[model samples]
Target: MQIKDFMIDQSLKELTEHRTVVLPIACYETTINENIHGYIPLHWHDELQFVLVRKGEASFQINEDKITVREGEGLFINSGCLHMAKDKNNNSGCVYICLNVSPSFVLSQELYTTFVNPYIQATNISYLHLVSKEFWANNILDSIMKVNQLIIENQPYFEIDISIHLTLIWKNLIMNGVQLEHEQKEMLKNKRMKQMLNWLHTHYAEKILLDDIARAGGLSRSECCRYFKRILKKTPLNYLTDYRIQKSLLLLQQPESNVTDVAYQVGFNSTSYFIDKFRKSMNMTPLVYKKYKNSHSPFVNNST
Candidate 1:
């Protein structure tokens, strides 16, 4: 299994905005396929997110818990929660509507504090898994889909409609949630993990060692390795290697860039070793992968 944190001595994010601030609510339709990076690597932001899987299936991981969501179902992830996603069925195409909403948007402070903030920050509720069998879950999924439909259609007053739908979802979550007690140490551990991941992701392209990774997490070298093994099922370096390979996959899509160019760009020194590692991870050579993508690209046929 490939595991990754932000970085050995840096953070992992590659976004211009630290938080979702362009709008109170942002909507996206994510179509999953092999060429487009099948996995949504781990990261967290301050906005509350909901995903409605319209087709196929995906497994959403929130910290240690992993839940598989199928068509017509969905999931709600709280703010600042460490999470990632993967295709539950291998090599299958899945379509989902992703919505990121600021917690305080369109709601009064009292309302948000009571119905939203508690749920987002509560230790008991890292996420709300919405399956068809459950009442509120089904309702939430319907509301999420409706919001996506409005966004794609780009109808007038869509923002107002989206916010209304979101309110319904939020109400359901607040009513159904059960708050649990939290341990101080668990909270501390979470903060440390976020910090370490952030550090590693920022500096992965440079030469770094285990000691640096450990210090990022405020743990000794052995403790750092053990922590990663316990949570991600791989050593720190193993995670770093996978992260490098994953980065290389994106760069290889550009036909102008040769294998050696892409390899050194992602911190690998030896072109031959990079090729060996790339093939081992992807089950194909970089050149072949690039050729495959160019031919099978979905955007090539504009007359569709």
Candidate 2:
């Protein structure tokens, strides 16, 4: 999939490439390259995902940890975990097949209660890295590849075959999954982070303060800064600044939009300050980027 843009909601939930409601499942071959920002930005979705890397390698940042999936390896991401994938070197790209399926599509009441819910609901296990070395993990990877094949082939009763394979994959997980202790504090922090992110996305166009962001997440000022740094690896204000610049990208692409108006529209108090930050982040002036983008120039700025 050559993703140009992602449709994300205020709460950081992904709303794009989600197929029909009836089946609630789809597969696509995704390439991480310069066209789509050279990375998949942080976003969460309600569907469980499996990524099988076919070539090169991709580094994934899931919440607080980072993992690298190489060729012939795969990964399983639990539903609603904040994650992003990119080529760390940024020279060669990574090619992978992704299968996203809603949990409700495969899990019945009994299945949820008995096998699937425990792992998916566990706060400590946001993702499982699958390697060909482990027998169980290899099985899961094979199943993911099989599902991808079924989707591509689209033979009669392919949906049923896909469902059966997915169910068995869950069964393999339940049977061989390692036990993990629950981290209640981590769960609470994740919830708070989501709350803060929602507030930021909802009101990025307006002037914001650190205290206001702390209040939205129900954290003290100091605690808010600490958590933001711990999880996101950036200060709250830094994140806000970057987000403002990201939003300004679309506005600057407009033919009639000027830099000054775009700056103030995205919460920058001064045009000079916005231009400085934009140049720092993008390595080019806003007007220059606008020109290159509008002309469909091959110049690629892979800065995220």
The models' CA-based lDDT, in order, is 0.74, 0.84
After superposing candidate 2, which stretches have Cα over 4 Å from the reference? 20-22, 297-304
lDDT of 2 by residue, 133-218 (tens): 98888898999899888877878888788889988878776666589656888778889999999999999989899999999999
What RMSD, rounded to one decimal, does every model reach? 4.8, 3.9
Worst lDDT run of 10 residues, candidate 1, spans 1-10
Error of 1 at 14 (Å): 6.7
* TM-score to native of every candidate shown: 0.85, 0.91
**lDDT, residue 35, model 2:** 37
TM for candidate 2 is 0.91
- The candidate that wins on lDDT is 2
Candidate 1: tens digits of C-alpha lDDT, residues 235-289: 9888887788888877887757788899888888888888888788778888888
lDDT of 2 at 99: 84
Off by over 4 Å in 1: 1-10, 13-23, 294-304
Count of backbone collisions in candidate 2? 0
Q: After superposition, how far is residue 260 of candidate 1 from its true place, in Å?
A: 2.1
